[model samples]
Target: MLKDFRAFIARGNVLDLAVGVIIGGAFATITKSLTDDIIMPVVGALFGGFDFSSYFIRLGAIPADYKGSVDSYAQLKAAGVPLLGYGEFLTVVINFVILAFIVFLLMRSVNKVIATVEREKAAGTAEPAAEPAEVVLLREIRDELKGRGAVPPTA
Candidate 1:
């Protein structure tokens, strides 16, 4: 059982999956940062500095002891207030869309390259190989023999 488990873990698919998961986690962090730090800020600036991060609906009443502003989503949440964080959700959704689109474009490019290589391979195999010099010489000799009526021209 242990040997079988070891073999399973040693498989190429398992290793590749592990590496992909690690890379995907790292990629997620970068995408999140890009969305949060760069894209959202630019988008906000374009929309007259409309901040989406603060957009939320209060689901519960603020405690009397809460000193922070009730309008602030972070402050309310930090004060144990229930809130519907639509803005944060929207930001995450946007990040996901961007990441997915980038991955799709990358895959499309890779697939195109693969398809081009496959077509070249297929074309190479479909075309006849150039005849060797000896084969050409033999064919010429046969043609001369046929012209002199020494041998019937074989098709």
Candidate 2:
């Protein structure tokens, strides 16, 4: 069972999947940073400094002991106030859209490369496959036999 597990882990697909997952996690972090640090701030500035992440609906009463600002979503949530954080949701949605667009562009480029290679192969512009050694040897023997007149040559 341990050997089987080792073999499964050693498979090319598993290794590729592991690499993809690690890269995907790193890419997601970059996408989130782009959305939060750059895009959201610019968008807020354009819309009269309307911060999306701070917009939330209070569902429950703030605790009496809470000392944080009432308008701050993070503070209200930390104060045990029930709230619907739709602005944060919107920010997450934007991050997802950006990541999806990047992945789409990457796939499109890969597909274009694949199509070009296929076209070259179809047009015989790609390098030809090498013949097997046995076939080459047989063809050499046939040529020698034809040259020596031991085998009939084609007209």
Candidate 3:
């Protein structure tokens, strides 16, 4: 069983998938950083220096003057406040949309590359150039005449 498991793990697809997962995880971290640390700040600044992340509707009296920049969703929930958490949700939605678009674009390019490779492979073995049917018939006739001791006509 251990040997079988090792063999399974050593398969080409399994190895590729593992590598892809690791690369994807790293890429996700980069994208998350870009979304949170870079893009969102610019987006927030554009809307009259307003950060949507801290904008929430409170249902209970955690504090009437709660600072907009309180850290973490757990804290908000723990504060016993009936909360909308709209800003955080909006941020996450934007991040998802951006990531989705990036993935879509990447997949589009990958598909194009796969298609091109398939097309090239198909082209490689599809067919060699063929003589015209009339030319083939004329060659057969010429060969038959030669076999019959006919003199060849000079072109």
lDDT of each: 0.92, 0.92, 0.83
Question: Per-prediction TM-score, please?
Answer: 0.80, 0.76, 0.66
Q: Cα-based RMSD of the predictions, in order?
A: 5.6, 7.0, 5.7
Number of backbone collisions per candidate = 0, 0, 0
Off by over 4 Å in 1: 124-128, 132-135, 138-155
List candidate 3 stretches off by more than 4 Å. Answer: 58-84, 131-155
lDDT of 1 at 64: 89
lDDT of 2 by residue, 1-155 (tens): 99999999999999999999999999999988888899889999999999898989999998889888999999898878999999989988888898999999999999999999999788897567899999999999999999999999877
Give the candidate number with the greatest TM-score: 1
lDDT of 2: 0.92
Tens-place lDDT per residue, model 3, 1-155, is: 99999999999999999999999999888888999999988998898887877777766556665654355455777656678888879988998888888899999999999999999999999878998999999989998898888956657
